[model samples]
Target: MFQDISCLEEIPIPDSLQPTIFIQNSLIKLVKNECVDKFCRIILESEQYKTKIIVEKLAEELVILSQIRQNRFHLISRICQNLFSESYYKEQLRPLLLRRIFRESSYYLLLCLYNDQIYSQNDIMNLILEQKRSDFAMYFAPEFGLIDTSIMIPKQWVKKVIKHLSDYQANDWALFKEYRTLGWLPNSIVAAIKKDDLDALLDFEVDSRFNINNFIEASPLEPFRLPRVNTYMSLAAIFGSINCFKLFYQSDIPVTDRIMHSAIAGGNYEIVRICARSVCDGFEAAIEYRQNEIMDWLLQNSLCKISSAVCMDWNNLLAALYLSDKTETNEILIKGMNEIYEGKAIAMPEIVSSSSNYF
Candidate 1:
């Protein structure tokens, strides 16, 4: 019977305690077979499963067995269905189920739970707050739309996060950027930018509590003199807010090559053009980094001097050649190569020759 447990739906839970123990064992066998739905049925219907210890143990078993394969979602769905339909299970088993999901399923399953809408915002708060894992709260914030609101992050949790941000590091912001689902920051930050609230921005920048040295250290600007100035500039460029970019430009922050690169990366061609003229090595950096649109803009604006000498190096020539699919660019690199090799009998590398069409 264990060899082919597909007929488990036909099996009934025996009434006697000893026979019920046997049935529970058989249900566990089905769990090992990844018959999670059937296992859930046994839990819902079996008299043996009415015993709290037995049910909890089997629930834990189902959670573990589901993890062995790609069947956890099915189990989660069944569990969620049971929670919504059965009040006793929701009251008695919900917290245990949540604790198990948190401990065993990892955050990917947490995200799946969010996507599945199996838990409400209050349910999450109760579950997460009881654990006192503030980091989990922050990580799960976006999923709850806790930080995606138009006004601000919810004030109840905002105080908690604000307190946490007192020791914020650049890496913290980087991690937030990587994991931010809808936008770069809570809507409050975006709203501040939209309104050009420099004072509010400055407050956030110099918030006394923030151990923001990791952020300041990464910047080329002076740490004491508003290290976040270029950061704001980058943010403005990212939003394509030309006026805000100009505001940052006119501020105390010195426009560095890095800022210009940020503008190029943001596709803010106009700001890139303006900064390219004043910022050192903007053209060369653009070429090296394959910022083709910015390079083209720089060339159009008479800002580039990428001539035969510049392309003599194999790497530089390759960058120039591969930066775009335009036929003219291919011709430019080819002509530069010809000019460089005019007096030599050097042969191009096989790789270079083979990739000629890539230009």
Candidate 2:
């Protein structure tokens, strides 16, 4: 009967009985095909001390099969989790098999390999934190059904997870969407913008859970919990992302002098314009930075005037003003120079003539 077993189209391994020799020998080929579900079920139902020894020997091959057929391997992962629950397996098989699986498997398989006993979630968390792979941690959540699943990672751990992942560069929008959909803190939004991920920003604006009213009401870089408003604005300006600055500006966060200067220095014209309409006290800094484009915009839009003091500081100031055909440019320069010379005359010490005093 065993000799002709290989000849059959589908091997009938009953769930009631332990795996036969033929079944064990043909496990690899069977796992690659439709027999995977039945084979995994048999192994899961059987004694781990027996089946685990067989599975451990075929660990590498099983991982490869799982990679090829993820759905099939997901069943295997579930079984591993189940087996890991038993104290005997926890004390014995976990070290022999699951430990190796954690190192060898990808996110999906590793998720299935998750046994909250032998290694707490924090242990894995520490491993990734120690390895500095926290940026990619979000990748594992979906495979574990954490994202969009009914299961909720408690709020405390969620904060820790969010904080760690926020420090890392996240390019996965699905992970980002999950963060938003889950109503996790928007600690990573600034990081996303700094990465110039416009799509992520766009997604945030549209996500139903995104509370724009609350966001706008909070101080600039509110989630940062530090003095990072300048850092926040600088990135938006440097990237020349008008949409980014709009987020802050619309939030009623006072666009500071440093922000305007940075926007001008970065040649972010739209940001400059957005900032110009507000209190722009960085005109001198803009001039210092040689941001002629910004100066031109400021002058052309009457956002700033070339004061007498500014004229005295600039060389050939008259020629610079004469270059613009704003007609009023010449008048402003002439008036400023007149004010300076008149002020100088008024401040000069008067010389009393002795002849006039004698007469």
Candidate 3:
């Protein structure tokens, strides 16, 4: 069953007339089970799958599996290696699987491995150059967790985004035009834009009188500055700051490397992960979106010697902790405390003291 999956991205999800009832029914039932190994069964029954959903279901299972069994991550990688390296199932499985690969902890390691493997086989920079050819078709990147497709730009909405940009650009209070233009509508920007007083807009929002679609018109403003800014760092050319993010390099500011702050402030997971060089941001983005699979992957990886920066943003951190279940909450607190002692976690004392119940 080992298929040449590296070339899988080359294959497209073909439109087929075949019905997917068997696989759909079988997998759905299997997905409902609280086991990760069932994913292997689902994979084994691949012949019955016909739609793109089997890919999603299998991915979900893999993530669940990884979260609970960090030691087995090598096995997980092998499964992935098999799917991508084989040709027989390449067209049918690879396309759907790679999209979900980043959702697994194995992906983080695999990406590093691919970098080394490709270097041995070819040139290093050439591999980085080839990345753009991957499904970065939209402004968002899955490496950042699922892109906020809700912020997607259609041809028709281009005018709406631009019109708002022109109107908001002149206002110092609305410096978020750049982020909005980049295809992101961060929740912080959403709450930050309304003038610092109770107004008709706020009223309309509370009373459900305002059009929710108006969210696309608002953007993130640079209200807060990184006092420890990376001297030569320029936010100008950071094109997808609103929707996606690049990794934080050695040039990054350790004191201000709050992954959650970067993520929810702009809602970009890539920026979040980039800062999480060692610590976990509690999977702030996925938690915000109730993306259980993504959150699971993060928690699993955090156990493997990962860490984040200081100056932790409370709003995002609290949101993540509260959104968790009993097991998740305890794990988060323990891991967070350990990181704090190790100086990997950010300090937000007031937040640590206050207890908010999350549903």
Candidate 4:
């Protein structure tokens, strides 16, 4: 009998009967499409197909495809957990799944550690160390009491891990104390500023070694130097951590036009207001970064002056006209320029076409 089995969804499975070849091939397609509900129903409800070697091969394909896509990891975990309840599936699939997960991603490895019954704590720790995932190893080792002193943390990750530990309130933990004793910690003041951990900053201030002037007077390259207002405080503005910026501001650190440029790039209106001083470079940065709010703010606040030699350059005007996405922003820029050059009778740039209405 010639049968049309092209539409797998329409195929009806009879009770207690083996799924035909068409249904089996359709199951593979379902796995690829991540149709979890239908895949599980068909596999679990069917008597013959679930026990076949093809099911094991399908599960392996699912893991490989999910890893490559960098998503649907939860579905993979759910599939394994559901299938693992059966002794035959568990015994057949465990080693293959674990090996694939270990080779794919540290994130997936960590997920398997928490979600699967396959890995012991020691196994996870070893995998973390092998992967050089210091962030994971630092917390996991301390939490599970699996600290391996011989494992070397990369220098770049050490400070970030320290900040994470403090954020998690793990400073009092023995591992933190051990890090301090071993001189693995960066400058506490800088760490506190970067973390916005005001409490830790206060505690450090009470120490005899804590000297605010030492940080302030230190050269920019010095290890003890305070965070730069232009760099670090600008980041604080981006993150909306006004308290951290205030901390730096109250310390009487010198502010400069570079700070305004950085704040403008960050696109925080309040920081731009607080740090506003020079608009020459700030306006250029705003134009380059396409920060419309900052551009509007600069024009509205009378901060931009095209009469300034810096802004009068043809390149600056051309860039502003070409890069501005909105006609309103371009008009604002031209209006600001016109206000500055009022009564000079100097003609506007030829690049300002009538179509843009920037006259």
Candidate 5:
């Protein structure tokens, strides 16, 4: 009898023949066979089977079977994915599946449903905070347009979201503005700096809480090392924001060699000129980025010498030089390599020959 019942799934029954009794019996057999596809097709095709009682019963059976079957999560999640297309099924199944899945700690399933737009913003936020899943909450909330509810999120999470937005180079002004209003002043400033939003940075400056000089002087490494206000002077250089660089430089933010390297890599001659007087050397950065103009300027201005003993990563620089066919730049690099060999007692030919292997 069960074999005959299971065979019924292969043939599409007429709509009039799809009574509730047939569907209920077939569903039990299908669940036994793990025929998730046919089970969903029967539910979706039959309007009568979409009722609350039927879906609730299916959910119960799946929950029970999931405990017994090792791959029950995958099977049930696949069923949910199929059922999500119908509005009525989506509404009915979401809560039932979420309740069962959440209880089982099947977070990947929860995330799949969340991505499918199963959870409302409030539902996810409450779920995340209650479970203390701040990592998931910080990234997921902003992406789902839940920035307005950021106040309810912890300060640390807010900082993390700000850093996330900044790192990904997302330009959500509404989100940034909200964070700024919440007294996460320093983090917002660093985000603005990293994003090269001078106007937004200036707007942040007007607030009495914003002590521009003091803010520049202080460097907090809480969120991550990259988004700190002091260390991010290189951001302006790399982004080719001369005005922003001027703003940071005038504030007496110390110009490190990294900043000069970033300026060289960015190929902005003006910012490079500004950083040239301050930083010790940018020879490797110029060669690596193939910034011929900056390379020439550095050498002509005597800002960086080929004879400098601090030629860190000579193989990388040599590879860059070998790849660059520019006669003038190659001459400078070859001379620099010779100078390194003469001064530092390092062999040049073997390193030069091996440099091509980097490609």
Candidate 6:
């Protein structure tokens, strides 16, 4: 009967008694096909052998099978998890086998691997916290079923990753809809925009723009917490970059980039005009900070041809209005007044005091 066993289409293990030579030999081929579900069941139930085989050997094989079939390996992973834990009962498996299993998994898989066990759990957690969105998710999702099966991870971890992913792409070129769709985006990103580290936010926002609808419509980055309103504006203004006009107009998100911060701080400039209608609620803060760039963007436009100032003579007007130690404010002021007289902005205001005189 044993001689003809290999000839069967799908091998069957018969265990009325313990440890059949036939099943033991076939273990190699059977595990490759996710047949371990049945094999494991047999091992636990049988009275066949006084000594059971080591679990690591089984786990090693399952890991190999998982890599080979890949797409359908969840079954193998489940089996591996079961076997790894079960093998500990014997304390007989190779030490390398356990470490190898953890290393092979992606972020989500590794996380699950670490969730319970105290030995390697902390190391795995540190890796998870350090990983970025695209790399982290793709690396681990396949092995751990991180993105596929929603049932495994708790709500808290899922939310944390989502938030971090959004912040990662905050400066990316993808549209809001596209960014929002990625598995990694989180609500904490928005909260960060509200009150995050001003210096960091300003530095990061330097080249980025807000193209979404009024800031309110734009989604938030999650997980990161906010600071006070004053701190939010001060640093963002000093370092914010030049972005689309609509961003200033539509910026209701409460955080202003450095350019706008400067414009608002300086007073009466096109930058201010751009932000005057913005959805962001902190223009008053811009005034408090004495954003010269913002003030110049607003006032300089009024000084040039109304239609041509921020639109046509942007460079020339901005150059004339944005002053440094050598740029002689009175000279630019005179030049601006003449331009205003010629174009006659609806109503250009007199030069405000130096932004530095106040906040």
For lDDT, the strongest prediction is 5
Query: Whole-model lDDT for model 1 versus the true structure?
Result: 0.48
Highest TM-score: which candidate?
5
| Inter-residue clash pairs, candidate 5 | none
Worst 10 contiguous positions by lDDT, candidate 3: 230-239
Candidate 6's residue-wise lDDT over 102-185, tens digit each?
A: 445323333333444422534443444543333333334323334432323434444654556454334442433233232123
Native-referenced Cα lDDT, model 4? 0.48
- Using Cα atoms with residue i matched to residue i, what is each candidate's TM-score against the true structure? 0.33, 0.29, 0.24, 0.33, 0.34, 0.26
Alpha-carbon runs more than 4 Å astray in model 4: 1-130, 144-153, 156-239, 247-252, 261-268, 278-359
lDDT against the true structure, per candidate, is 0.48, 0.46, 0.35, 0.48, 0.54, 0.36
* TM-score of candidate 4 against the unseen true structure: 0.33
What digit string (tens of lDDT, one per residue) describes model 3 on residues 1-359?
Answer: 11222321222221331122222223222332233346444555566443444454444544444332223344545555554454534565554444444333223333333433411223322232344322221212212322233333333333444456444445542544334332234333233232222242244346555443321321212222221231111121022242212212332434233434333233234554554554455454343333333344455565222112111342223223333446644454445544543457555443344432311
How far is 174's C-alpha from truth in model 3 (Å)?
Answer: 45
**Residue ranges of candidate 5 with Cα displaced over 4 Å:** 1-187, 208-232, 251-258, 287-292, 306-359
Show how many residue pairs clash in every candidate, following the order shown. Answer: 0, 0, 14, 0, 0, 49
lDDT by residue for model 4 over 92-116, one digit each (tens)? 6665565555454333434444656
TM-score of 5: 0.34
lDDT of 5: 0.54
Off by over 4 Å in 3: 1-42, 56-72, 81-88, 95-107, 111-127, 132-359
For candidate 5, the 10 contiguous residues with the lowest summed lDDT are 218-227
**In candidate 6, what residue range of length 10 has the lowest lDDT sum?**
217-226
